[model samples]
Target: MTLTLYTNPQSRGRIARWMVEETGAPYEAVILDYSTTMKDEGYRAINPMLKVPAIRHDDRIVTECAAICAYLAEAFPEAELDPRPGELADYYRWLFFAAGPLEQAVTNASMGVTPNENQQRMVGYGDFARVIDVLEQAVGRAPYIAGDRFTAADVYVGSGVMWYTQFGLVEKRPVFLDYIARLQERPAYRRAAEKDDAALAAAASGDQGG
Candidate 1:
């Protein structure tokens, strides 16, 4: 069955587009305007949250950027974007780490919210410093997140690294700089960037016209 991708240029949907490019999958993209289209009834049926970056493959529907990355990797085995079954510990570990701890840490930091000492214990990310240190070590040890091979984990984690570093939300350590440099070298990543940039430009022009 043909795949349908629901996305907005400015949203996390860019990550899903990159994953689709990596998979070499032919899919139709449905770009929704941030104003009203996303809240429409048709789009709401696919995602109750009315969010972008959801995918429909045959009878299956997948939401969430990280979930979509992993799903696409598994769906297209020829892409070789996932580690073998037995060697998947790091794959699952860092993917969730980026999605959960790393994301929360960055968000908290961006919002200028620092929990008290006692509250830190209850926080999933502990502290931003600790989260950065762990993530730096994880990527520093290997060229890719899931050991020697590049996997879907990198798509999600790398996107976080790329976005965070670009906006100065995270420290630009040498390890992160090098890792993002490597990710940028990929053809799929370049293709996705160009496509998103064009989409954003078009949207801006449309807004100016109306």
Candidate 2:
């Protein structure tokens, strides 16, 4: 099986990289730049959205970081990233929650787009505070998002928690920080981060030499 990941070190592609690392699958990485290669017609054929973090497995293409995580978990089940029997509910729940509501709320909040009570009804996440409260309760409930063991859910959710807290996009609640701390201990997480950091450094060096 041939698997290829198209990503940029500076984008949400890092989350996809982490999920790929968690799957323990052999794959090739094709790094793209936002201004040029990513938007080129050749790359647009792969993803019309013109975004990083898309993957091609054989002939099948998958885009979006959340979808990539879920796909990789199922694709490499031997890695045990897929949810266990009882974990299905929580697994999908928090996975979509992070992908949809959490992300929407955070992005809107970051752009100073708080919804009024009436607008909240139309917004899927209701309000930023509500989303944060629910998320806090979620991580506080168990060792992992899907229960006792880490699953693809944590990879997506943990990335959100880590990024959100780091940028102050969300309130740096203790629960969020603690949850991120647990995920940081994973070997896959560390490896993925180091790879991205090295990629970033390489890009910087190239720019300097130019």
Candidate 3:
């Protein structure tokens, strides 16, 4: 089956790109621009949300960066990104935790949307500080998010730590920096970043020429 990735260079699509690279599978990338191709009717057919980073694996369509990471891990078993028997609990637990609470907490904090004490009960992450503390504990507990080995969960959570820290959305704690440093050293991660960086440069050059 052929895998196709629909993404933009400068979005959460980078997370999906890294996941695809980790699979070591041959795939086609369809780059979309937010104001043009991304909003087109044809693209909307694949994702009504008009979002990038959606993948078409033969007849299957998977959207959301976390979902894409998890789906690709399962789809390409040879990649060994899937969790082993002993790692199952930590794998699913942290993966969903990063996708749900962590993301919500970071994004909300970035936009100055902190919830009050009463409102904290209604939110899944409670508060930004608590979320950061929990995340610090998670990454500090092991060499990888799911256990001693790296898995698809790291792709999502690592990307979150990398991006959040770089952009000041989250704190640059010793643990987060250490975790992301390890992940950044991976060949697949390097390759994915180079590709996106080239794309971003090309887009900027095009804008200047026009």
Candidate 4:
């Protein structure tokens, strides 16, 4: 598989980076800085929407973080992080739930635009309280999202929780705090983070010389 990932370490693409590391394949990774137009006409040819975490898998180009992570795990099932047929429902459910409610709530919280509890139906995530309640139910039940075993869902939710916490979009609840800490202990996450840090450091040193 001549896979090439176009990503930014600071973006949601970090989840994709961990997936690629888990893939254990000889894939090329291109890191884009904030100054670059990742969605510019040139890069947009790979993904017209111009999003990071896009990958060229042979002839199949894929975009979006969770999509890329889900796809790669299946494409490299020897890696074993892939979801099975029976887990399909919950896998897609939690991932989609995260993509929708998690983003809306987190963005609203960051912008201080969360809806009042009474007028929640007027908002997308129905206020941060509702969002938190829903997550507490789903997450608190699991050895993983699909239950009993780890799957690609963890990668997506783990990243979402980690990011929202970083942005102070979510309250520091024990469950989320513990989840993030546990997720960070994954070897694949360590590998990608180490690579990203080293690359960032080298780039910083280069700018100093210039």
| Reference-based lDDT, each prediction | 0.91, 0.92, 0.92, 0.79
lDDT of 1 by residue, 24-119 (tens): 989888888877889999989999998889999988999999999999999999999977885599999999999999999999999999978898
Each candidate: RMSD to true structure? Answer: 2.0, 1.8, 2.0, 2.6
As a TM-score, model 4 comes out at 0.88
Per-candidate TM-scores read 0.96, 0.97, 0.97, 0.88
How much is 116 displaced in model 4, in angstroms? 5.5
lDDT of 3: 0.92
Q: Cα RMSD (Å) between model 2 and the true structure?
A: 1.8
Off by over 4 Å in 2: 207-210
The collision pairs in model 4 are none
Best by lDDT: 3
Cα TM-score of candidate 3: 0.97
- lDDT, candidate 2, 1-210, per-residue tens: 999989899999999999999988888988888899999999999999999889999999999988999999999999999999899999999999999999999999999999999999999999998899999999999999999999999999999999998998988888888899899999999999998888888887875221
lDDT of 3 by residue, 1-210 (tens): 999999888999999999999999999888888899899999999999999989999999999998999999999999999999999999999999999999999889888998999999998889999889999999999999988999999999999999999999888999999999899999999999998888888788885221
* Local lDDT at 154 for model 3: 98
lDDT of 4 by residue, 52-135 (tens): 879999999999887887898889889888778888888888888898887878787778785776768766677787787788
Off by over 4 Å in 1: 207-210
